[model samples]
Target: MSTNPQKVHFIAVGGAVMHNLALALAKKGYQVTGSDDEIYDPAKSRLENAGILPQNIGWDESKITDDLDAVILGMHARKDNPELLKAQEKGIKIYSFPEYVYEQSKEKQRIVIAGSHGKTSITSIILHVLKYYNRNFDYLVGAQIEGFDLMVKLTDDAPTIIIEGDEYLSSALEMKSKFLFYHPHIALFSGIAWDHFNVFPKFEDYVKAFEELAEGMPKAGAIVFDETDNMVDVICEKERADVAKLPYGAHPYEVKDGVSYLITEKGKVPLKIFGEHNMKNLHGAKKVLERLAITEDMFYEAIQTFSGAAKRLEKLGSNAHTQIYRDFAHAPSKVEATTKAGKELQPDRELIACYELHTYSSLNKDFLPHYADKLNAADKAAVFYSPHTLEIKKMPAISAEEIKKAFGREDIEVFTQKEELENYLKAQNWYESNLLLMSSGTFGGSDLNKLTEMVLALPTNKKEKAKPAAKKGSVLGKLFKKKS
Candidate 1:
C-alpha cells in the first residue's frame, strides 16, 4: 500500500471482475494500466472509455517497470505470462485478484458470502439493503448489480466491505481457493453443491474447500449458513466452539397473483424477487443484516425495491400474457432451483424451461447424472449444447441419448443446434406460458432480448391451431440424429 496515488498494472485486465477492479482503482486516482491478449465487449468498451485500455493487445515487458506500485494478476493469465516474468525479475510486488481484494479490505470488517449456487444473489441483497439505507460500505460482488457502477470497490473511509467469495482457484500459480484468502470476520455459506469440476474433481474435495472456509473464521467471528443444506449444517455444527454459528431457512411467504410477499410481524413485505431459494437467500441476508444492527423495519423497507442481481431470474421482457426470464444457472442445483421458482411464481402459466449445458462440469459425462429430475417441474423441458464447445474443451463427444439418459427423463428434448432450438421455441404459443432460459453461457450466442420480443409478438390466437406433423427428415428429426 502506498501513501501516494498507486501505480497499478493489471496483467489480464479484460476479465469481468478484473476490468471492473481496474476501473475502480482508476476512479480512486490510481494510475492504472493493464494488458490482455484479448479484450471482449463491455470490458473492452468500458476500459477504452476509462482510457485504461492497453495501447496494444499483447504483453509488453516494458510496461512492468520498477516504478510501478503493484501488479495485479488476473486468473486468466498464466504463470509464463511475459509481463509477469518481467515483474518477478524486477522484484515488484504481485498480487492475485483475490489476494489484492483481501489486501485492500484487510483493515475493514470483511463479510464474505460463499456458496456454489446462491452466493451472488445473497451478496446482492445485502448490498442492496446497505445502499438503500445510505450505508457507506464498499463491496465486491460477482454480478453487475443495479445502482453499483463497479463490481469491485475499495475506498479509504468505508468501514466495511462485503465480498462475494468464489470457490474457484485463485490464479494459475496459486492453487488455493479464492475465498480462503479473505479471512472473513463474518461469513455466510449459502449452500454447497459440487461445481468447477475442472478444479475440484472429487465431491469430498469440493466439500473440504468449504469446510476450510468455515474453520478459518476468526475466534469471535460469526458464520451464517443455509440450514436446509445437510452438508452445510454438518460443517457449521462442527466449526470451532469459539465462533458463532447462525443458520437460516426459507422465510415464511405467500404468493398472490404471481407476486410474493414476505410474512412479517409488522406486516406483509412485498418483494420484487421470488422463489424458494431466493426466500432462503433473503433469510440468510437478513441474518447478516441483523448481525450488523440493521433493524427488521429497515431491512424490509430497503428490500422491497431490490429487484435482483442481473441474470438471476431477471425478467428480460414481458407482455400482458407472457413473461421471459433468463438466469445464470448452469449447475444442476441452480437449474433445478431456478426452474422450480419460475413455475411457482406463475402456477397458472405453462412453464417451458430451456437449459444450456455449457460449463465444464455440466458437459462432463461423469457430472451429467447430477441433473437427474432437476427439470421435472417444467411442463416442457429442453436442453441445448454446442458441439463446438465440446471440441473446444477437448472433451469426449456426448450424444443426445447420453444427455437424455443422464437426466432420467425420456421425454426431455435435446438440441445440438441453436437455430433448431430457437425455431422450436418460436413455434410455441406463449399466450399463457412463461419461458425460463438457464445457462452459464448464451444459448450458442442467441440474442435473448430479440428472442423474447419474438415470443411476445407471436399470435396469441394460434394456440387452438394444431401444429403440423414433423417431416421424417426435418430439423426436429435431426435433433435425434445418431452420431456416425
Candidate 2:
C-alpha cells in the first residue's frame, strides 16, 4: 500500500521499461526520482506528469547519498556513470532493473513467456484472460495491452505475476540475461533464434540463455515449450528430472471463408486473429494458462475479442481496394514468421514485404548470414535502413547489395531515402494486393498509417472478366477471394 515510502533513485530512467517501473513505484507511494541525458517525447511527458522528473537532464554524483535505500540502473547507463560511481563509493545498494524485478516478484507465482518473437503476444494473451476473469495479478509486459494502462505493476495484494521475459542483459554491470532473474515457476519458450549480436556475438552463445532457464528450474515447476522449434526442443528436452516439461506445437485450425477457427473437441472456437504463427502462439498460451489452473473453455472465451498487442500486427490504414499492415518484426526468425504469416492469409495475392535493419544484431555484417532466405515467402521484398542511424550507433556502413546478398535474394530492393521509398510506394499498384511492413523501428519516421491510407485510396475498378471495370467494390473483396 501507500504506507511505506522508500526512496528509490533511477539512473537513465527514460527507457521504455524504466519509465514504466518508476511510475509503478511512485504510484505505490514510494518517493521516486529519475534522470536521463536527454528525455524525449512521451517519456518526458510521462515523467513530468508523475512529478518525479529531475530538474537537470544529466546525472549528478551529488544526488547519490547513503540516505537513498536503493538505486535502479537502466541499460542506457554506462559503467562509469558519475552517479553510479558515487553510489558504489558510498556503499549504497545498487540493482539492475531485472534484479529489482526479481526482488519484487519473489513472493508471487511467476509465469514467464520467453521467445525471440511471440513472447509479448503470449504474455498479453494470458494477461487478457486473467483480466477477463477479474483475477488479481502483478505483471511486467513489453507492450501496452488494451486493459493495462502501464506496462509494469507491483502490488502486495496480487499473488501472481506474469512477465514478458526478454533475453537482453540487465545492464552494463550485470552481464546476465534479464529472464535469468525471473526464475519462473512456470516458463514458456515459443522459440529461440540468434539475436543481440552486440552481446552474445555467436549463435551458440545466444542459444545458451534458454539452456540456463531449463537447468535452473525446480523439479516440480512446469516448463512449456514449442516442439516445432528445433533449438527450443533441444533445450527443454534435456531438462532436470524433477521439472515437468510440457510441449505444445501448432493448434490444428482451418481458414474458413477468410477467418481462422480453432478445432476443439467441445466446439470450433472463432478467432479474430489469423496466421499459423498465431495459432502456435495460441497453443503455447493455452498450455501456460492451464498450468495456472485456467480452464480450457475460459481461455478460448477470453481471447475471442483480443485484437492483439498494439503494432504487433497493426492496421495502419486500408481502403476497399488494398490493405496495409505493419509489424514489430526485426530479428531473422521474426522476419520469416511475419512474412510467411501474411502470405498464408492470401495465397494468390501479391505480398510486398518491407523491413528496416534497425536492431544492432541485424546491422552487423558478421551476423547477416543468419537472415538467409528469410524473405523468400514475400513476392516483393525491400530492405530500408538509414546510414545516419549506423553512424549514430557507431556501426560500420552497410550497402543495399550487402543486405541483398546476406538475405540470399537477388531481386531484393534496398533504400537509404525515406522519401524515395515513400514516393516509389505511392507509384505502385495496390489493387488486389497486400502490403506487409516489418521493422522494430519506424522506417525513417515515416507514418505507416498515412502510407496505408494513401495505398488504400488507389482507384478501384471492377469487371466480369480479368480486364479492369468501372469503379465498384473495394480491394478487400478481391484479396478475400484470392485467399479462398
| Local distance difference test, each candidate | 0.90, 0.84
Predicted candidate 2 versus true structure: per-residue lDDT over 1-484, tens digit per residue: 5676888999999998899999999988899988889888678888899898889899888889788999999989999999999989998899999899889888889988998879998988888888999999999999888878789999878999999999999898998899998999989999998789898987788788888877888768988999999889989988487888899998989887557898989889888777888999989999988877899888888888887887787667666556678899989888989888888877756678898999898888877767777888887778999998899889999977777777767677899888977876776677667899998888998887777777787665542323222222224333333542
Backbone clashes, candidate 1? 0
Candidate 2 C-alpha error for residue 92, in Å: 1.4
TM agreement with the true structure for every prediction: 0.94, 0.93
> Candidate 1, which segments miss by more than 4 Å at Cα?
1-3, 462-484
The regions of model 2 sitting more than 4 angstroms off are 460-484
- Please estimate how well model 2 matches the true structure, expressed as its whole-model Cα lDDT: 0.84
lDDT of 1 by residue, 1-484 (tens): 3368999999999999999999999988899999999999999999999999998998998999889989999899999999999999999999999999888887899999999889999999999999988898999999999999999889988999999999999887788899999999999999988899988998889999999999888988999999999889999877486899998999999999999999999889999999999999999999999988899999999999999999999998998889999999988889989999999998878888999999999999977877776887887889999999999999999998888777756667899888989899988888888999999888999998898888899887535523322212323223323320
Every model: Cα RMSD to truth: 5.0, 6.5
